[model samples]
Target: MLAEVQADELVSVDDLIPDQAAEFVSQLSTVEPLPPDDDEMIEDETSENLVEDDSDRSRPVRENGSIYFGECRLLNWTTTAKGGMKADLAILDCPADAVHPFKGLLCGKQNGQRLRVWFGELADTDVPMQVNYQGEALLLRWSDDSVNGMNTQVMLDDGPDGVKGTHPFTGLPIGRVEGHRMKMAVWAINDDESVIDPRKVKRKVPFYQKPETTQAHLLSRRPRFISYVKRHERRLTRGQEIRADITIAPDEYIAEALYAILGITSRSELGDENAVGREARRRWSSLVGEYFDDFYGRR
Candidate 1:
């Protein structure tokens, strides 16, 4: 009864080996030993899979491609090798669910750098163009050659993966571009208080504003402060005054600066803006005040 129960319970080859069944025991000696080294076997497998055609060596098997799913702000036009042209893009907003690891590639961790979009022969023209790779699409409108920046709403394609392409400049394997839509805005305030929209304007409208005296004062008083202000200057409205004192509450520039100085890289790290960012700004203001006090004492 015990043997019958054991036989019924056995469900796999492992159980049968331990049971020492007559068929398994008889077949053990006939089982051939594996080769000592598998290098020859591996070589044989590789040889069978490799393409034998020599003509295919002249060109890449797959073309290079990349999909950037974020708020890409056109900083300025740049000249490339052989007099080619490319737009410098600053990735403003990358989603948390972004498929690619684009943190450092989008912008440098320390000194920020813009991503380049090579226009090749099409640089001089003011035209709307489309760049599609691996289902990801970029609708670019080059109004004209000017410092006036532009922004657009982009949705990363989450479609079926396509043949990988090598980045022409970087020589890195470009994977599928996948992400969601992000908010983007770039416009200049006109003299008549009307906004110069990039979509409506056929030609690139130059973004110009009279330099505020307060801005110069802030620069003279605190040079380091300019870096922080420039990063978040988009938050300011037309003709918004930038205060010299850093004690302003709910200031985006101050909050961004505090995050940088404190080494808080991500928005997620800034838990509770009032608790983390606001408090840090307060402490920073106090520190700056003390520094000025010490300077006056030395004099």
Candidate 2:
């Protein structure tokens, strides 16, 4: 079982990370020659007495050039009654190829006790109104509920009566259009036009591989959405599933999002051979091992 986060921080070292696991990460840092000690006394101390801080020392290494990939599981997760239908649910899908820098893990109460993380800049794309779903330009506000780290779900059925951007998640007025593609802008806030977007923010990430189990997870997610769309959108009953494709500004965004969602890289680009999927699965196993090792070591 995964450790649960207490308060607002990561799980206590005793619960989440074990001493052996911590030592392993420390060993990796030493092998990789991570940042040298800045404190004169600590630098002079013998290895026997040196204590590891495990601070944000990994930050600079990320900037130096490390690619992060792989997906993270929301272990021992619980959901609100409204989202209970998705309870036994899992989703494993990634966008196009993208790059992201490594940001150390995030352990939070809401996100469970552990979270593997990375950082990177997202590519920029002008999603003209024509290419957007339906025919209107919709200004989207990224509420926490709608946008997960690399995944964003817009409830097409839940919006204002007439506005094209009206969302069912939250009843908000939206601007409407009739053309195939319309131009929309991402703003800091719903009304504010000046705040820069995080998608515009740049960074690099580790390249993680996808797991074969994820294929099963994907099959799980696809069906749930299909069922939901079919039940909610009467028009979709014509044997047509609601199509939603994951896209990023740069190809790197795809990779980054995949890593964020699945905590693994994908062999989708490689070939349809089961081997490719199997390889992705192998990588996921490695990642899980590393994650647990660090978790136990820290404890």
Candidate 3:
């Protein structure tokens, strides 16, 4: 179940995002994150921290009169990923009214360095461009380089699971998309079979409810949180560990920070379904209990 948030507690829907993000996202209608500053750049492992002030990364960006659901903490931004793989954590917040946009950030380890990305700039991975709207049965395409791309072309109506509506490749509805906010489960695909396989390590992502909130509120909000678990594993070993991260929309710093803690801790405690599930539930319960009195005492 989800906790109830008072409207008073939320920034007026209009002010959900700050001015900078608003202006930046607006330009996505025709622009894209200038390619990687340098091809030799590498991802930073320590750049994972949330924006403490309502500065650049924390402010929300507006689009189509709705809050843009893209923002995150910079996790890594290296001149070169080198032989090892780089992981990132980001939180997306596509409101019911806003176009569900996909974006991410790469960070530099010093804790302050980072790079931002709009879904349009992520074409490298072939992130699904067009998804059949579940309710409308319309295929939306990424037309230009802007946030929603450019033009939204409805290719086809809703159909089978893989073809349209909601499916894996089309990460739309892939995360928790409900009410005023949504959350995403992020992963970094690596070359190592052991790392990518669910049997070795699996993780879920978490998100904040409103545009602006404290770390306590960020930690307390559970509905938008992603829960991860290892589906297959035995005799967990430290060397086989994997890196998993988290992200929050409207800010890159926070996502990186959440990723480091959750990733390192969760990876160290890898376990089978029963054990992992139990731990996840416990962590969730404890978190929810601390903030929501209504959720704490109940099953």
In the range 1-299, model 2's lDDT, one tens digit per residue, is: 00121343422322322332333222212112123444322221211122222333322121112122222222122224342201011112223332222122211223111111121111223221111212111221111222333321121212231224322112212211211111111111112212212221122121222223433233223333223333433232233332343332323433333343333445352234466555555554543454345436742
How high is each candidate's TM-score?
0.16, 0.17, 0.17
Off by over 4 Å in 2: 1-151, 154-184, 188-194, 197-291, 294-299
Clashes of each: 3, 62, 45
For model 3, how does the per-residue alpha-carbon lDDT over 1-299 read when each residue is reduced to its tens digit?
Answer: 00122444434422433332334334323221122222222221111223222122332332221222333322221122232222232233434344323222222233211112222211222232221111111111222243432222122212331123222123222222221212212121222211111111111112332121232234423333322112111112223442333343323332332323233233223222566545544444444344344324443
Using lDDT as the measure, what is the rank order of every candidate, best first?
1, 3, 2
Off by over 4 Å in 3: 1-99, 102-267, 288-299
Against the true structure, candidate 2 has what lDDT? 0.26
Candidate 1 lDDT tens digits, 1-299: 11222444423333222222223223222212222332211111110121111111111111011122224433443333432332334444444333222211112222122221221111112332223222222233322212322223222212232213322123212211332222122222122323222111111111111112222222233434444354444442223444434555434545444445433443344233656655544544443344344436642
